[model samples]
Target: MNKVVLVTGANSGIGLALCERLLSDDAEGLQLCLACRNMQRAHAARSALLASHPSAQVALLQMDTSSISSVIAASQEVKLRYNRVDYLYLNAGIMPNPHFDMKAFFKGLFSSNIITMFATGEGILTQKDCLTHDGLQSVFATNLFGHFLLIRELEPVLCYAGRTSQLVWTSSSNAHRSAFNVEDIQHQRGTQPYSSSKYACDLLSLALNTHYNKQGLSSSVICPGFVMTSLTYSILPSFPAFLWTLLMPLFWLIRIFTNTFTLTPYNGTEALFWLFKQKPESLDPQAKYHSLTSGLGNNYTEPRKMDVDLATSEALYEKLLQLENDVRKKLKEKQKESQHVMHHGSFA
Candidate 1:
């Protein structure tokens, strides 16, 4: 039987590659759902995949992770379509209107390789959409809170299914512990909202593992090394990306010394694809997988320092439950208010 897989942001990048790779695997067939915000792009992606593997089962679902209504609607659609989801890949994210510092970029170029890629703020950028539909930062909403809610909504299917299910989150090496402040998960006080969002995802993944693994649901995180995806293209201007592309050979050499220098989407997604072959119990629930590249351009998978504190992870889980309840209560109150208005008009 085929496994039902739901991949968010499957229209492009690692999500698309993961869907293609899953379809190519011979162990089982896949009922792959590409949950994306853009229907046209999702259609094109679905068509392209079906062209190569005509027998591939593909479905498109419109979802904007920044909106609570969109998440709820998409989850309801999934519940109606599939009895169970064996795999859930939370891959949709945003770095809206990133401000890349060119001076920092050149300064890091002259520094040591590690500093150039990891420590320095050259490759780092700032996002603009700190406001979401839920009054949170758009980055945190799409990357963390929205997906958190999606998982909550789909828990019945993922956890109580006939078989075990896996939830893989596309985290980042740049997700430093300091980037996240428990007090302000929205990162309203900082310019590095993307990093903050990723950090929150790290904590959220840990929380999921701790809370739900015993219940037969497993959650893990992976850093899709620096992928040259459409996301990257959008963040950096064409000229910079082109320049970075030209330096691809140098990047491969750097990958030998620094694991975070993964320069391609395929290599960046290696860990994500590799995890698909494993049983949930065999994985390290507390660790985040790193998608690394070798010196010769070969892709490899490794484990990096996962900054997961159980206390913090648990705290976040409780916070999420409160947020979910609050959102539901607010929605119910609004609906009742609207109904009262309608009833008065009809009586009048």
Candidate 2:
């Protein structure tokens, strides 16, 4: 039987690149499923993959990771279509209303932390996050919570006796410890909701390994470094396409000292594709794999110890469970109410 690989946000960027690489590497041994919010984009992605490998198996799934209902529905569809998921790539993420602090960027350029700033995007970028229909922070909902819900729903297929399943998250170098608070996992009070949510992912991945490793489920997070995707381009919305092209030389120059500039989507997926060939048991529970590119433009993966600890991760996990319960209860009530209205009448 062929291994099943499901990737969320697979329509573009690193997700699409990973799909291409996987199909190219083993067109006969793998089944590729591309889950995206937009069916048009998903079809296009599937078409593109099929165009290259006409004999490969490629499926399309519609999933909006920001919505709880959508994630649940998608997971149910997944379980109905496949016996088990060998690899689940939680790559869907959003960074909305990004603001790049040029003052801070310029200041960091002269400071000793220049390389750190360029590598991590810390102290220089922030985002304005809003609420989802589920009443959760949008960034947190899209980046972490919805993926968590999907995992919960897919537990049956993911956790099986004498078998292993992998959960690979597209985390980021921007996931700093300072941005996360156990009391504010959603970061409703903070401007850097993207960072906070990503930090939550790092913490959550650790907690998942602790809980599910014995059940044959392994979770690992990876930082794509500073990939120049649409998400990164949003950080500098004022810069035109031509201006960004003009800055490529400067970016490549910066790559000499800090190898975090895996600027292309293919390079950004180095760690993800690497993980595809690795044994889940061999991966470290406390480490985050990073996609790095040298000045020579060679792509590689490196594992670095994350700052997350067990206690905080556990606390956040419990809170997330509570939130999930609350949301499901509310959704149930709404469904029942709608049924009642149809049984009777809207009014009189």
Candidate 3:
């Protein structure tokens, strides 16, 4: 039997690299689904993957993880196409309008926290977030809630009695417990929405394990470390691509002290690809697996304990369920209003 794997944000960066790695690992008997927001990029990624492995089973699904309706529609399409989802990679995320704080970077450089700063990119990074059409924070919706909705919608296919399914989230080393608040799950008033959203993912993954483990479904999270993808390049938009090329030596030097500087997307996907080959039942729920690269460019996966507990994970899971209910109600009302408007317009 062929193993089916679905990856969100599958067009580029770590997600795309994972897809390529998965094909290279098992080119013959793998069904790969590339779920992306942009159809053009999705098609291009599919073409590129197919170019390398002509006989690979590759398909595409249009999904904007930030949008609730899109996720619902995409899940329905997925259910129609595949009977079971062996692996679901919740790799879709965004760190929008990132403002790099040079003062903090400089301060950390002079302080004893230099290693911490370089390893995590914590103090130097902040993102400007916006509200989505659903009246939720865009970063929270995209990174956390959208994937939650997708999983909930695909529960039937994910939970099976005879076999197991795995949910692998592309989280980050920057996911800090301090950034998340139980009351402000949407991070509407927070500047570090990206960090908060990822932390939420960490909590949610634990919650899913608690609830779904009995049904033969397991959830895990991985931090791809400091990868230089388009998302990272957007942080210092003023710095041209060639300048980044010049800074490669500096990045390599940092890698010597801080192994978190995986640098490339292919290297960053180490933990994600590692988890693909592991038994889900043996994984720890409280651990966030990290992709690390040594100075000599050796890549490996390590599991680090997260700053989360069962109480907090359960609380977040309940809060998310409540939010899902509210969003679904709003969607239903909007649909009814649209139908009512059409009904009245027919007489005119």
Taking the candidates one at a time, how many backbone clashes does each contain? 1, 0, 0
Inter-residue clash pairs, candidate 1: 130-137
Runs of candidate 1 with Cα error greater than 4 angstroms are 113-123, 238-245, 341-348
Q: What value does the lDDT take at residue 258 in candidate 3?
A: 83
RMSD of 3: 1.2
Candidate 2 per-residue C-alpha lDDT over 214-265 given as tens digits, one digit per residue, 9 for 90 to 100: 9999999999988888887888989789988987887888899888999899
The lDDT values for all models are: 0.83, 0.92, 0.93
- lDDT of candidate 2? 0.92
The TM-scores, one per candidate, come to: 0.93, 0.97, 0.97
Alpha-carbon deviation at 9 in model 2, angstroms: 0.7
Best candidate according to TM-score? 3
Model 2 bad stretches (over 4 Å): 110-112, 346-348
lDDT of 1 by residue, 157-222 (tens): 898645899999998866877878887777888878888888889899888988888778999899
How much is 77 displaced in model 2, in angstroms?
0.4
Pitting candidate 1 against candidate 2, the one with the higher lDDT is 2
When 2 and 3 are scored with lDDT, the better candidate is 3
Q: Per-residue lDDT for 111-143 in model 3, tens only?
A: 878777866777899889998888889999999
